[model samples]
Target: MRNSIFLFVLSLISFGTFFQAQKIGDGETVDVNGLQVSLNITNKESVQVGGKPFDRYKVSASVKNSSDKSYTIRLTSYPQIVLDTGIVELDCVNATGAKLTSKKIQLKMKTQMINVSYSAYDKSGKSVSNVLPVIGSYYFDSGDIISDNAIFIVPSGEKPEVNVRALR
Candidate 1:
């Protein structure tokens, strides 16, 4: 067996039984010990800074304990977005951090990566009571599309008639 190191900053529960994953993405759901956890992304706003336009994104994370036993859960999001305006001081914050910024204006924020860690479960099946983290980033480049399977795209719109581009 190959042993691998995890990037988890903090995890208390092993959750071997419900170890679905360590990182999550937008609109993705994870189940742990009869608890349902989901993450989502939404467009917050658009603004112009220094004559440059910028966009803001908001990430909402939530956990629902569906079991009869009372438990606590915490969720955190690690945004892969990077701040790159070519300015040293302006590029200090990350894409995820800028989304949470109250100023509501971030420049050249581009989403590059996103990760979510959940409140681990112990052998005794206990959890921590903490609200899930609200993460945000700029750009909807689908920076967190982590699918191992193949992807197929089917475009559906105003289909052009066959004779439209035929013999003119």
Candidate 2:
């Protein structure tokens, strides 16, 4: 009976911690596996995609890998919009250029390669080439802090706070 109760309590704690999310606002940092990541809303505007208008938010994500072992992180699954109505998951594009899905990154050991991944597109639904990184993966050596920006579109008039799931 005592062991069952202890196990139940332990499970409850683990479950809560697993689902816990951190609301990281502009310039706020979240640490995961000794990697420091900060996100900020750099700009916002209305953009045309597939002949429809959408509100797009340009977010800058910075990551510093300081751990001994490498880690892979997914930006599409981790980034979310916190609004008054509810939480909105950012739209993502698959590798084949399809919609409704997300992105992932790889952190290599030894060399400390931080695989930063994001999906970005321009007005014509093409990969952006201006100041933003395109829809692909990026790598950085270990112990190096790098800053990159991505464009995420959502409903109009909803200024959502950036929420990131710090997963291990």
Candidate 3:
């Protein structure tokens, strides 16, 4: 039928129009100590979560260790989300969703939170921080844009390994 042919042509046009579509935020690299850290968001798709729809994005953190010895450090993503009110500065400790390589270096890809839900209230019911409001559990419209930066945290030793007995 003519309708079927028209549908096929429409599909082909859509593919040709966006054949080389890239992620929203990509092509960014940084150095953490002696390691190379590259961050990118890809595989974007419209998904539904908790009775709400969202455009979810997958984040990839590729770390390359050039040093001979393996380094032990955690990757903390500091996400700055732009909300309708203002930019919400996600805390380092509270927003560390995934921990990076504790042994070797490689690609650490994970699905990020699309419809992130959080209230700005402490146990005492006090508004401690500004909220990253989610509109209707899906669309996150704000004045500022959401952005992220990765930090390499050098884990501190639990206890001193000094020879206290020997010194005594």
Highest TM-score scorer: 2
All candidates: TM-score: 0.28, 0.42, 0.27
Q: What pairs collide in candidate 3?
A: none
Give the alpha-carbon lDDT of every model: 0.33, 0.51, 0.34
Candidate 2: C-alpha lDDT: 0.51
Candidate order by decreasing lDDT: 2, 3, 1
- Best-fitting candidate, measured by lDDT? 2
**Candidate 3 structure, TM-score to reference:** 0.27
What's the lDDT for residue 133 in model 3? 33
For residues 140-161, write the lDDT of model 3, one tens digit per residue.
2212122443432222321111
lDDT of 3 at 27: 51
What range of 10 consecutive residues in model 2 has the weakest lDDT sum?
82-91
Model 2 Cα lDDT, one tens digit per residue, 1-168: 999999999999978864564555666777755667677778888766677666676666766777775443323442333222111122122111213312322222222223455568978889854453332322344677666556566555655455444434
Q: How does model 2 score by TM-score? A: 0.42
